[model samples]
Target: MVLDLITIGWRYTMDFRRPTTTAPAQTPEEAYRQLRSLADESALRNLGALYSMAVDDHDIDTVVAMFAEDGSFTRAGHTVQGHTALRDFYIGMMDRYVTTLHIPNSHVITVDDDTATGILTGQAELSLNGTLMMAAYRYDDRYARQDGRWVFAARTLKFMYVVPIEQMPTSFGDSKRIRWPETPYAEADLPEALPTWDSYKC
Candidate 1:
């Protein structure tokens, strides 16, 4: 259900500024520190891609794999957790659509050693039996390093808008990689984390 509320959106003034993080070492000492930072950045970006690959492959298993064992996905007023909800949600969606495109852009990735956080802004368009619908929102994610791997621990999202098929609006694209846009942006692309995004295996 896409909202009819449309006004060129602006940055939300949140009482909370940035996520709290650990202090980086003052040591300009080793190349390893910089490498670790880069690696962490890479992992954060992968968080976004994992979501894309999960939906694109129609593999809820891959989707759930992106999360920690007790991790949860929250959107709108619904929350899905563990693995069962993960499976059920996607399986249920299959009844209505054959394919979906998850266009993620404006990603904000924050990293520190064994933990990182991300805010992913993007739109998703679903083509159900040839009918098209679009949705726009932000995914505020909390990730942790578990057993030497990065996984989503919590995901909070807020919908900015949606354009349903009933409205005859069609700007959604097909199944492919989504590129980030560059204007009138309510969202911002802070940094990219390729490691987190690349966790999903096709």
Candidate 2:
């Protein structure tokens, strides 16, 4: 009986005291800043994905938009600059190639007050025209923060070699494939624990 009375008294004291709310509420400015930060992060992730898609589709329009006006692509003793130059380069590449697959990795974005810089690594495979050469390359990309947005500032591509030329099968008059090459441009495997679009279950 005494223990029950003591418990009732404690409960009454807790109810009367009213829990002290110590946490400070965010100010209006702080809330806005946090929302903007989230928006910027989303933009960066989407930008990276867009870059991958543009190169894969050989979409010159999208590719040009991804870079700044003076952005440069450097590879094989050549540096292509500006949107017009970029268009010329892409068109020329398409004429000499059937397809290209570009994959970007090791992404790092540094935000500074009003500006940011993004550094990343990328790899590509290009199927050339006329010859059965497979061009394999890796890239180091630099992006700039402009007008509250990020854009590619420069890109440098390094290639080990244009391989698979020796494995080309002889041309035949018919549609049937007679000779199979020992080596082909096999797609690179995704890293372990890679998250696919289907994995989201969205």
Candidate 3:
């Protein structure tokens, strides 16, 4: 049945082979290398979840430690580099919220030697200045192995929408979906704004 499926152009989606172009490892050394690669990929993907937990917990130290010493983070046009800058950035940002719960939904990672890149999507429920708000967002990440552990080399954050939870129903249909309290309404940075999204239109 499996061979018949393959003959009909149905590739095995459950294959655990890495670098898909290559065949399965035959020698023990080659097997070890493949295992190491998978381990690195797992660690890199976990970085996103670890970051979300640290941020929601207001743990600046753990958050900054996830990045390389000279790593950087970019969000909403502002970029902060190095551990000191990253530490300060999170400190100020977390202070604006009374509490937050970040849910990391999905992550896709590509590994090349000791470096990697990933895209992560998630949502968050926030208590900002006592007002309940929700956000849908994505992170574009770059990672490097340093001292035998994966760390973020750089990360860029983009928001699909951020609105008061009560406004969720109407927010997506509105042009300006970023509805932060006391701030002017602003456009979301996803879907319609993505190049592929525009190309797919009729």
Candidate 4:
């Protein structure tokens, strides 16, 4: 009889606790906004994927067209601006590599009105002068909605590390400093500083 009374008392205490309140229903405008945001994110991701493929295929024209007319690509502290300059840069870069493949590790995009920003991290394999070279890179990209399409307004490349396949050590120790390559252009054309340390280094 005592045990039964204790069980009943516990049940009565729980009954007085309030149930969780559900979130309010989203309004029509809120629903539409969320849908639009999703679409924009999808388009931005597609843009990055296309870029990787185009570069690996040595399709310079297609790659250049993916950017805005006034778009710019900055790499290794040097900035290439305008369609003409970007085309030349890609052509020269492709010439240096007989074959290449870029494997995207991850990408994330944040949308703001007609503009968006994204970061892409990837590993690249290149055959240069009969030697295989591997590189890890990150691109900080800015996108603008032009003519209802997402196009790159600016893309900045940060090379985490690049080493000949045979030269890569089994482990990256400390990784507090990085060995940055010299720019292909004159010193005047490069940025003041370049980031070398890994962003997610433990």
The lDDT leader among the candidates is: 3
User: How far does residue 58 in candidate 1 sit from its true spot (Å)?
Assistant: 0.2
CA lDDT for candidate 1:
0.63
Q: lDDT of candidate 4?
A: 0.70
1-202: candidate 3 lDDT, tens digit per residue: 1112224222111222433455689999999878887798788768888889999989889999999999999888778999999988899889888899999987767688888777788999999887999999888777898988899998888889999999998888886988999999998877666544655465
Worst 10 residues of 4 by lDDT: 9-18
Worst 10 residues of 3 by lDDT: 1-10
Candidate 4, superposed: residue stretches over 4 Å from native: 1-25, 174-202
**Candidate that scores best on TM-score:** 3
Query: lDDT per model, in order?
Result: 0.63, 0.56, 0.81, 0.70
Residue-wise C-alpha lDDT for candidate 2, range 1-202, written one tens digit per residue: 1111123211101111122222333898867766665566567767877877886787879988888899988864489999999989978876766777777665555444454444445655556544455433344455677786777777765443344545323322222221223444332212211233245576
Q: Could you estimate the TM-score for every candidate?
A: 0.65, 0.54, 0.85, 0.74
Better of 1 and 4 by lDDT: 4
Task: Indicate the TM-score of model 3.
Answer: 0.85
Sort order, TM-score high to low? 3, 4, 1, 2
